[model samples]
Target: MRIGYFLSCEEYAPDQLIEQARLAQDAGFHGLWISDHFHPWNDAQGQSPFVWSIIGALSQAVRIPVTTAVTCPILRIHPAVIAQAAATSAVLHDGRFVLGVGTGEALNEHITGARWPFAEERLDMLEEAVDVMRQLWEGDFVTHHGRHYTVEQARIYTRPPAAPKVYVSAFGPRSVQVAARIGDGYISTQPDADLVKQFRQFGGGDKPAQGAFKGCYAATEDEGVRVAHRLWGTSGVPGELAQVLPSPRHFEQAAQLVTPEMTRESLPCGPDPAPYAEQLKTYADAGFDEVYVANIGPRYAEFIDMFRREFL
Candidate 1:
């Protein structure tokens, strides 16, 4: 399985993200996956730069392929606008960029003051948005009027040599079906064999299936768990709560119930590479073609070093 490093935009500045991309490449990571978020889960993790600007910089800073772990095109931005941004990104990356998209979370989309749609409606919007983007990427003037979006006489002038592959992110059966039908590949956070099987059976076939997980590498297990819980406890929030929470403050409130023990159970922690390797194997064994790992906290260089020596 190919391994990549995930750049958590919610926790790092633009320059730091670029630096980490460089470090990831130097450390022998096969590719890069960067989160595209308008806000951090909570104020404590603290940073969220415009993802497109960072992608532009990454084009010049690194040679490896890059993907937006996922971007939402239906809410805050028009599908036509996202098409243009993604087209530009593809060109900038020399066709090495993959546009991974999803229905998105209220934490990012609600900032536009738009009413957050229910999950089924959001999936419809995502499907329509993908259709709009694919049409725009064809480099021909296009006009489209769909349930959730519209585009008129739109075309991408700076198209890449080839259009970037669109990967759909899904966490449930319905969304998985949508991804199978509309996406060139599939993306998810979990390493569920059943999900992978479902995706393949529903038309994904041999297309890539990518998964991601978070880890915290510190000198001691306690130190690592402490940082992971402080920065990513929101990850332990159960069910579809992440999809509907309207703001970082709301997420912070919900995250209060997420204990450090829960965080440690969900994310691999500490200097011991054994747990990290074991966790990653779950993704590989689940039939994921690629897996991306995000390291929590400030010791990025050390984590990369350890990853290269012990995990890579």
Candidate 2:
């Protein structure tokens, strides 16, 4: 499986992210995945720079292909706009960019003051948005009047030689089906073999499947767990809470119920490489074509070095 580094926009500044991309490429990582968010999950995570600007910088900084771990095109922005931005990103990356999209979360999309729709409704909107984006990427003047969106005489003038592949992110069976039906590839955070099977069964065929996981490499497991808890404890917040939380403060409130132990349990935290290797193997064994790993706190250089010597 191809191993990539995941850039967390919520936790690092734009320059730091660009630097990480260079470091990752130097360390022999095959690709990069970046989180696209309007806001961080909690105040402790701190930063959420405009992802498009960072992608532009990444194109100049590294040769490796990059993908938005997942961008939500259904709510905050119209699909046509996302299509244009993605097309521009592909041009900047010399056609080495993949567009990963999802149904979205209220934490980011609700900021536009639109009511958060149910998962089924959001999935429907995602389907329509994908349709609109694909139509726009064809480089023709198009008029679309769909249930959730409308585009009139829109054409993307600055498109790349070829449109980037669209990977749909899904966590459940229904969404997996949606991804199989509409996406060029599939993306998820879990290493569930059943989900991959479902995706392949539903026409995904030989399309690429990607998975991601978070880890913290530190001098000791305790330090890693502490830092991860401070910054990413929100990760342990269960179920639909992540999709429904309205703001950072709301996420913080919900994350209060999450303990440091939970964070440690969920993420591979420590100096030992065995656990990290084991975690990554789950993805590979589950049939993922690629897997991206993210370091939770500082010590990124150490993490990359360890990855080279131990995991890579």
Any residue pairs clashing in model 2, and if so which?
none
lDDT of 2: 0.93
Residues 56-169, candidate 1: write the lDDT tens digits: 999999999999989999999998999999999999998999999999999999887889999999999999999889888898999997777878788789999788899999
TM-score of each: 0.99, 0.99
Model 2 scores worst on lDDT over the 10 consecutive residues at: 303-312
Model 2 per-residue lDDT at 200? 97
Runs of candidate 1 exceeding 4 Å displacement: none
> Candidate 1: lDDT of 305?
93
Least accurate 10 contiguous residues by lDDT in model 1 = 146-155
